[model samples]
Target: MSVTAAKGFTAAGIVAGIKENGNPDLALVVNTGPRRAAAGVFTSNRVKAAPVLWSEQVLKSGRLSAVILNSGGANACTGPKGFQDTHATAEKVADVLGVGAGEVAVCSTGLIGVLLPMDKLLPGVETAVGQLSEHGGEKAAIAIKTTDTVHKTSVVTKDGWTVGGMAKGAGMLAPGLATMLVVLTTDADLDSDALDKALRAATKVTFDRVDSDGCMSTNDTVLLLASGASEVTPEYAEFAEAVRAVCDDLGQQLIRDAEGASKDIKVEVINAATEDDAVEVGRSIARNNLLKCAIHGEDPNWGRVLSAIGTTSAAFEPDRLNVAINGVWVCKNGGVGEDRDKVDMRYREVHIVADLAAGSETATIWTNDLTADYVHENSAYSS
Candidate 1:
């Protein structure tokens, strides 16, 4: 479906002079309200970007009229100037929209330690405001990307409500939201409490489970805004489910498009003592570069998976572990299975299953295969 038909929100993207590439670097999303509640989740990294800190504070009100974002400068570790830049950006957007500064949230991504060029950014916000349209979702998605090859977006409809989202991330991705930037828009009527609860739960399973390169970022942010534009207030349960599905799709896409990545890997942990245990075990495997590299090489290395899981606190007997790759049983009773050669790593997708043999719980994590290209790309990233 078209992003306009799906999101029912207005957006704009413009080149704000933040990037040297001259590509679009500033974006704006506004809900032409019937004002709806909003929810946000920022990076878990203690060293957060200035925008992240500002948005987190504003999100407490559960009311958002607009979001302003920029790329090419993270505005992290820039000290007081960073906060001032964020404040100035939001104030500008609020002034343009005739709303309070606190009513607008801000986000930024790109190079770290560099100050935001207010001279370039201030005027860019004005240009973005002029370009707002329902068709701007795709442009906004592309504007947020740093090393990503493509923009990620997803939409789903259920009952009478719609949930739509755009995401961007390529490197410095790991759990606790994956060094990603996301904006979710919905027309369902929901309160701040319900939106916050739903966003947190959905993120725990989706964005929180993806681990690409295992490095977190200072600029990750996921903002969800409900415009109540649909005027359809479905049950909270149904609305949350639709939101989860959108996040799940976007999270998988982020893994698929990770920088220098050739394969998207799925790690599943089953029969853990509890859901938390299952998630922990799955995440451990997802974050292991050695295991990811082994999978990239098409080596059904059950030992690597087992070793990674061992680092987790999940209660499991190593001797009872069972491993499978691409539906081919590669290990049984903690030993190598007979069909290890059947698993292929040459494809763009890879799957690994680990049976904890402890209980009836399961969790899955999405990741990217490690390659020498990944090393080369990151090694020279700043050069």
Candidate 2:
């Protein structure tokens, strides 16, 4: 059901003519709630989008009644006018929902540096609001797609409570805070503090581990809202686990649907002295373009892995390092160890293991192979 799968929430998606192609480009998600508790994370890029700046301020109140998102324009680098557009959008949502403008959060995604068609969007807001329905979650998810080929949604249920989420990203998929726009809703009895705690814990290992193209978006946003309609107060740990499960699933889906990617690579860093060390090593391997090209070519290249690790500050002994590809140990003690000819590379998924031999901590990062399709898709992206 996506965001509207949770109790006390309704959503709708409509064609706003913001996209010249006439696709449904605007989505509205509302909290018909007994409680309006929420938390969010945005892109760490210094060049933030106008909508992100507005939503970041709205979320400081630690409550949100509704969120409006559009996929036809990024509204970044458009100066003060862009922020005004976002502000006006929130005011429009507030007017219709009978709430203060401060209670509404807004998100926009698409080509950067372009102004949105407010003549089309402002009126579309009223139309989308009239069509709000709990079953409209899937439509909202579909409306967020840009270069993505598929819509992403995930749901997990527990006793008397459930968490549902929707995400969209096909490029600029890197980790800082979030790589794309994601909306998560839960029916549990949670306050803003509880949600902030749960969301930070979830995105740490999930969204933060995905590094598809190593490019961070200026408008990335991940928001979690709670309606408290289930009337069930779940344990903090249990609720956090459920949130993590949904984020993890959505992150994996983003990687699988990454733009022009032929192989999905999973890099596992083991035997690290600390979790941070493991994560750094894994992220380094995941972002290595040379290693990604090797995986796409079905070539077992242990040298590239060592080169990536050497650039990181993670704890490791050069001579004691080990590397494995698809269950075949290709390098041992920082040199050639296993037969590269025995490694399998026919599958779309490739697994690479890096052993630091420093301790027992571990972490994994997901990435996709670079290809000609990726270059072409981005080169002609704005046309």
Candidate 3:
């Protein structure tokens, strides 16, 4: 289940000499399409990466014929030269694929404030183009890794068409789209407007709700390209649901593979005055380092959860709040309800439910427990 799983796409991943360790660091994904309608969502970060800036411009036309990705350097904060390198790379891909430079999108990941070796990247693009294949999606997915231990891909097939995608992220995972570079492809007949509507709606609850390290990246990007290869236009609602399912699956995969995380925590906030209130409360709870540490130690410290909730401006009465850990009501009516020891935390998955008791709206945020491994990994990441 990958980008090439959809019709009208070819992909390749190859070693580009960008990574000193000699892993595959370059990827090319091309839409051999009858229609190149596209939509994109990028990092809201003010300090955007060079590739992100370039891709944003390319996406303004709502068309993309190809995407080139690299995983050894973020190409961010390197000033005009960095952007020049990104442009040169896109131009190379376009040259090889016989498409306009503006029809190419670029994505890069890895350390920030460094320039990519254009000498290697431009040549790598030519090599990647030579190897493009329908079976290359898996390789392309594997090529876009930074700290990720495993590559992630998801696919959902409707009655007549399919939506497939690949995502790369393992750390710096937070709201504002998370530290991820995601490319989704669909053969369903849809215009850029429809794709944008479905992508934004799906990501709002999927990628936007994932808060692993409470940090955002300058290079986060998600793009959806439609080829209209299947020549099938399902109902808008049905198409949107398929996109949501794939994005949700990929989001869960990111949480599961979060750096140094032993427990995947799902924070669900319910009965809020509005959806915004619910999301705010859930993010507050998920981003609470104290609660994450407690979860790491298998301690069902509901107080941390309550304190996190209290910090939010959401509509909730202190006396009417309720909290549950692993299906045990640890806090009911804002007071201790059940034995904390009754909460089980032996498994890798932990569920926390926060009831605001203000309305019927609800939201869920996915995160992971903080641990020593995470600290160690990130502390020495630059090395």
- Per-candidate TM-score against the hidden true structure: 0.96, 0.98, 0.98
lDDT of 2 by residue, 1-383 (tens): 99988899999989989988999899999998999999999888999999999999999999999999998888988899999999999999999989999999999988788888999999999999999999999999998887778899999999999999999985345222123899999999999999999999999888888889888889989999999999999999999999999999999999999988999899999999999999999988988889888788888889999999999999888999999999999999999898999998999999999999999999999899878887887777666
What stretches of model 1 exceed 4 Å from their correct place? 1-8, 171-178
Each prediction's Cα lDDT score? 0.84, 0.90, 0.91
TM-score for candidate 2, please give it: 0.98
lDDT of 3 by residue, 192-237 (tens): 9999999999999899988788888899999999999999988999
Ranked candidates (lDDT, high to low): 3, 2, 1
- For 1-383, candidate 1 gives per-residue lDDT tens digits of 21333445888878888889898888888888786589999888999889999999999899998999887878889999889999999999999888899999998887778898999999888898899898888888878767777778898987777889888886345222235788999888888899899999999889988878778899889988988878888898888898899999989888888877888888888998999999889889988888888878878888999899889999998889999998987888888786777777778888899999999999998888888888877777656
Candidate 1 residue pairs in clash (backbone atoms < 3 Å):
none
TM-score computed on alpha carbons, candidate 3: 0.98
Our model 3 lands, by Cα RMSD against the true structure, at 1.7
RMSD of each: 2.1, 1.8, 1.7
Q: What's the CA error at residue 127 for candidate 2, in Å?
A: 0.7
